[model samples]
Target: MDKQIIISIGREYGSGGHEIGRKIAKLLDIPFYDRNLLDEIADAKNVDAKKLEKYDEAPSRMFLSRTVRGFSNSPSVNIAEMQFDLLREKAAAGESFVIVGRCSEDLFKEVKGLFSVFILGDYETKLDRVMERRSLSAKEAALAIERHDRNRKAYHNHFCNGKWGDSRNYDMCINSSRLGVDGTVEYLKDYVDRFIKTL
Candidate 1:
């Protein structure tokens, strides 16, 4: 594989995609970008990290919020744009990184050495995972999953041409529920290894 490969992961809620990306980055000894991307962008744009986080991976529904927050004139300077700027800067610098869940898989489609992976899980497994991770009851976990999945889908559809969680948009789609977290990471590592050989 090229030394400056970028791996972008798109994942459904409770799919363990972040963990998988982190593990893959660790295995490859590369930097990992997730919520940290938001922090960086928030700092760069002089925006509140909390507000950016509130709208992260969510479709914009806050024109008044932005105006009230003194972000009216520069409406285009949204979190997504800031995140994209950061991602573009890093890619232009020939950085190798694994990025998780930011509509990045679609955004970097034209970039060389960029691989997009989508992770999804069966509903039952996803609910279980969310419950465990968030210490929520089953019903609460299911609701959270549904809400997040809807937001993610809406965010991707609004921001990118492709539909979120659709296999056709990605280089590969894996069912983390079937392989489990560590196994999924191992599989992705091997897949990347093979992909590099082709390069």
Candidate 2:
């Protein structure tokens, strides 16, 4: 059997990365994991999905007093371990999936038959998408976007300890905002096809 292509996506804030994944999933008729994934993991583990939502697709650390951060007990390691366990179990199930964020690319590094994708876009395009989706004023949107990006960076770094958006870490990187969601999805479908043939 052909090994499943597990598309793990890392994206810039407001890059429409999530929507692109959803569209791709629908087109391929496969499952896509995002926030809803937190729900599944939570239920299976008897953990509160709501509590995980605090870190959902967002970073656990965006900004903190250096002093406070220094004092944080290493308790986060427990949560990290649980999430990692969940990721491994899911990957072993061998289902086609489009999984977003949580440093999934790094998490699945040793897993055979996986493809990692990174999605990004120009600042202005990302900002526009954020504004439209959140219905926030310019000032509000700008602040929120920056915050979200930082949070993801901090979150991914916390576990992966590598640079985000580094091309080598992913199989393909797309500018979804430039492709305008649907275009990006179609592009990814084509991209995945070529990738599958090579394997």
Candidate 3:
């Protein structure tokens, strides 16, 4: 097997971003972590995984509220932190993995090996993808797009102090909807192959 690598994906809602990460991982024969990151965290903390998922990558808008938002007096936060700490370690330990959301890029900011990417798409394109993927009515898709974007932006801004879709925070940024999911994955794989050879 090839040496492990870490791919951290930051995506706009409905951008077909998560699947791109997964495809890369699958093709590369590595672990793909999105919800699993939280699951692992929840496991270590012995907290309800569902509850953490609800607040996962979500933040309250008010600055003060955001400060206290993830701060639970319970052992949950500690467990989550420990799980994340392990993730950071694993990425550096050369286990090529795909990570979606949860600020994995930011959390592993100082870690040595990572291909950080930010995924984006036009508003309508995102809405269309969301409708198709989530099997939601157009109206429901619209609501999901708006709500998810807002929550994600707020969450990334709150926790990572970075824009959700900003290229500066990422090594590469791609418009996935334009490329479509499979095309996007192939593009990324090719990019990574070339990138790794140079490294």
True-vs-predicted CA distance for residue 171, candidate 1, Å: 0.9
The TM-score leader among the candidates is 1
Per-residue lDDT of model 1, residues 1-199, tens digit only: 2566889999989999999999999999899998888788778778787776775665766454355454443333377767777888998988889999777887788876788999999999999889999999999998999898888887788778888888999999989999899999999999998776765
Sorted by TM-score (best first), the order is 1, 2, 3
lDDT of 3 by residue, 1-199 (tens): 4645678898888888887888898998888887777776667678778877655555653533322565654333344455567777776566777888877778877765678999998888898888888899989999998898888777677557677788888999888877788999999999888777755
Which candidate number maximizes lDDT? Answer: 1
How would you encode candidate 2's per-residue C-alpha lDDT over 80-187 as one tens digit per residue?
A: 556667777777887667788868899887766677888999888888878888898888888988898887877787778568888888878878766688888888
Off by over 4 Å in 3: 60-83
lDDT, candidate 1, residue 130?
Answer: 92
TM-score of decoy 2: 0.85
lDDT of 1 at 152: 80
Ranked by lDDT, the better of candidates 1 and 3 is 1
Local distance difference test, each candidate: 0.83, 0.76, 0.77
